[model samples]
Target: MRTLAATAAALTALLTVLAGTTGTAAAAGPTPLAPADLTGSVAVTGISLSWRQPAGGPAVASFRVYEGGAVVRRTATTSAPMQYLGVNTTHTYTVTAVSSNGVESPPSAPFTGTTWTLGMAPQCDEPAPLTVFDVTSSALSVRWSVGRASPQLALTVNGRDYGIVPGTSLRVGGLTPDTAYTIALRRANCDPRTAPVGYATTRTLPGATNATAAPRNLATTARTDRSVGLTWPAPSDGSYVHQYAVYDGAYRVATTWTPSATVTGLFHGTVHRFTVAALDVAGNESEHSPVLSLSTAACPVLPPSPSRVTATAVTASTLRLDWTLESTAGSYTVLDGDSAVATVTDPGAVLTGLAPASPHSLRVVGSLPGCPDTPASAPLTVTTLPGPTDRPVAPLGFRVAQPTVVNTYDADVPLSWTPLPGLAYRLYDGATVVGTYPGNAVTLRTRGAERHQYRLTAVNANGDESPPTAPVDVITPFLVAP
Candidate 1:
């Protein structure tokens, strides 16, 4: 019985010790979960790996990524990107999680990635074909096709690097004139050895020279009121002429590519002097050619003076002047007692601000473009009608005459009203005045089958017009064949 008690006590003590050890171990460090869903991708120069955070485990303090048994990266996040790897190479990666207590979990499933070759670099696949043109004395144009959108390229000219440019072409300027240059192109961030090589050399052009020969045979070809035209022969010297500069007097009027040019904005009947000089492409101008003197044509003559001038007093202070012109006139001027009373474009004008019952001398003149004032026509002498002491009585017996005949193209109708001595009558067809006459009768012609309404008014010396006569509607029949 003593030996059994001793063995039982030892067993109890051993169980207590084992339990204490287990508790201590659990407190010191927590087991972290393994990373899940490992994924990787290959880039031009490196590989990138990612994984999902393990669930149902102690919070991870950091992550570790491995590549083929080698620790490639360590981070506190679930992603790892490694670079500067061999091109066209394949790699394997795995991820693990570490707990805050410094305990590590098992690694994630292996993921493989392959680094891209230089040919797979962005915008480097099937590089653009190169071209060189616009060879000049101091500039060259280099162009290439961009196989991809937004391509960036690097260019080198005579050992000078023009850091990465965005477009597929570039113009190299400020170069030595009449000299050769070596040009090269490549893709951005690509190894010189791996990128396709393209090179060219510029050809030299002839050096520029001054233009020393003036244009010859300069003469006036045409002249007008507002412009003068000139023509000249090209310079005989070997230098190329890019343009010709024409001068009117001391002012440079125009520059033209051809030998002929017109200097505009000149005055009629004005004399102008012109000279021309030849200019080269290099901005060198030759001496001026011989001075050419030319004169614009004289101002045009005015239309003939208005004829058959007649003046009649419409009121005590107003006189109506009428005239006829041989041709159309641009404008007309009416003069009373040496002063311009009215200016009109038509042949007739009304003169106002005159004395009542007084004699006035009136004249009319016609004008045209470029001719401001024409000579005054023959004077017309007339006495204004005397002002009436009282309103005149209305005329009586207004009627249309008989025998309204239809001509080949028009109808002729005669109209008459009771005569009022010393008074003028105005005849109207609708609202338009057909005629003004001292007599009481008038005739009118109109198109066939057209209706005509006639009315008459009597005007006194004081410009007072009586009420219109009764209207008479007249329609003429169409002309019959004879």
Candidate 2:
């Protein structure tokens, strides 16, 4: 007998060939059957039911299958030698035959089939052909050529399998938005699962905080009414950064690979400060750099206040004064006895045209271009014509270390000076002698009206007092020993 192969569909084509009637060729009448001559029982997945049967002939039209007290049908022919006695509703199943003349035969025997049992779980197996095909920012699709192997094969995830659903593809949702997740696949088909076979890991999408390396060298330049052009190195500096964030203080200005950013809607003729930060793939942001400052072209703003104004008695007609220079100081003025004696555009203030041996009161004032003038320094009494004789000679080999932070005038600040074999040395607080050290270093308590002044003078064997030297403001007392 010839068996015809069917179409491309697996189950449809397979069943089409097996669904034919018995004795299509030259077989004779139906043969006699006995339970003792029956073949062994067979089982298959997805089949509603299965059975064993004895051989017979073409005269038999079908078989009567029995379960519990009711009757079910298979092929409806005794000679077909094949029947699908599906055990859908009953506990035990048995099969008998029916002839073309409608004669019913005795029940064949009963056997127990597969069903759900309490505490009886399916066998667990590794996923077959579990392969990842496509990966995206938030998901990865994997294909596994895995199916049920037993009467009831369950699909397992992580460790346990969920039974019933017969679909192949399953979506792994609720995964981390932008992180790696370890997935372990499992298939349960036994009473007790041994272990899951398939294991895989994949990364997910990323948010803004999940940056690795941030931007670098973010600076602003070129100005219009309200627009400013900002230039940066790159988003991913040599691939160190996964992305970048351009921020205007607290808010993000832009996010992308664009190296240059144009910021508008700024106040005209006003200067603004901006900053840039970088991020890497691991979500680590680098430290922020120094603030880059830029401004629009406007009239010069008021200058900052001046500090630490020092006056040196130059002469009666001329007094030279120095001050710590800052960009904000527009001009310096020398006031004598509440009157502006000299006003100079230069940072230093010089006062001239004064009477000799006169007790003149002087004050230094700092003023900006448009801002109000501020008088900070107190009235200083500067006398003139103490003459070139007051000039002092510095002791030989003078070296001292001043404290930048903790300065105590009484503290012993170490000093190294050239050894003067015969000349006696004296330390002066301005014109007055403050101390005399037998050696190069001497401990002197800095004392004065405004600040401590220090100078060194040497005496020859003739007992002549050398002129006084320039003094320094010892704000920190830690430098007292000299």
Candidate 3:
């Protein structure tokens, strides 16, 4: 009985200890569930893996992806993309869920995937068989071929990448003149370990020189007061010439890429000496061509004043004037008093439309192209005869326009009036008739510094006169007639 009691007590104590151990585990927290539905998608050199979250367990904070029993990625999302793997290879992966308290659950089932084969993956073939041609002082052309059809190749000039080239041939410019350069072509978008497929070395042609590339037949084509045109034959080595420089005596006046050029802004009636030289792409100048002489057109001069002016009455309303000049005159104008009457090309001009039986004062002036009219000749006086008996009505609206300047030696007062047909107008200076004119407007030449009262009247061919206009006062500038 004593041994049985001791055994019962020991069994009870063992049961209590077991119950306490179970309660402690329940208080700690729930265990995280492992990820489920693990799967993978394959690519050329990579695998993308994904899994579902546990449906019944403590919330997961993160997921860990395992590859070949090693943790390759730890992510909070359900998917992960793996890269940089060997082509035509296989990979296996697994995933586990992590609790908020940093506890890890059991891993999900392993998944296997295979990358694309070497033939199935994208490929870049290297360019081969390089050829160089048409090399010049500042540029060169290159071409190449490939054993198989492929994407365009990238070009390397002097170890610098120039991006992908679209065609098999390329012409490169903006290079140093007369220089050697290294060129290479390689497959584009390929592994960095791949080597270039084609390489070539070429040197540009030598630069041109004045002694070797001087232009021939440098001749002047045209000349003007402000400009000159010149043209020349291309040099023997024309392929090397890039431009031409024109020099005025010793100064460089112009530069052109063609064989001809124009020099501008020259002085009128002046002689000029010009020369031209050839320049290469390297800015090397050749010896200048033979000097060419040219002369611009002469500057214009004012026409000389007329001399020996004479007037003669031809009819009651017509007169003839003649004059001579030293230089060639383009035309001559006859002036009655200070008003221009008519213009003629020859030395003599017929002055028509004159008042009958009226005294007149006339002079001649010459004009030339591109010059001002010459000064008037000394005045000549003449009188016309009377006509049939007929009287004209009185003129109206007579007035004067101020500020009239005739010439350095004379003062002209401009006057106007309403005109009548078949009649002539006459101006009076204080009852003394100054001059008679055919038109309603007249310019009266006055002398001496004095205010004069003037009146106007209309006269017929019969020497008859109408009532005079109200007198107008005119203050003349002090001048002496010559």
Index of the highest-TM-score prediction = 1
lDDT of 1: 0.61
Which candidate number would show the highest lDDT if scored against the true structure?
A: 3
Q: Estimate every model's Cα lDDT from 0 to 1.
A: 0.61, 0.44, 0.63
Which lDDT tens digits does candidate 3 get at residues 40-65? Answer: 55555467675655446776656778
TM-score of each: 0.26, 0.23, 0.23
For model 3, the run of ten residues with the poorest summed lDDT: 14-23
How well does candidate 2 score on lDDT at residue 418?
58
Stretches > 4 Å off in candidate 1: 1-209, 300-482
| Best first by lDDT, ranked | 3, 1, 2
Candidate 2 similarity to native, TM-score: 0.23
Model 1 sits at a Cα RMSD from the real structure of 49.1
Between candidates 2 and 3, name the one with more favorable lDDT. 3
- Which candidate, 1 or 3, has the higher lDDT? 3
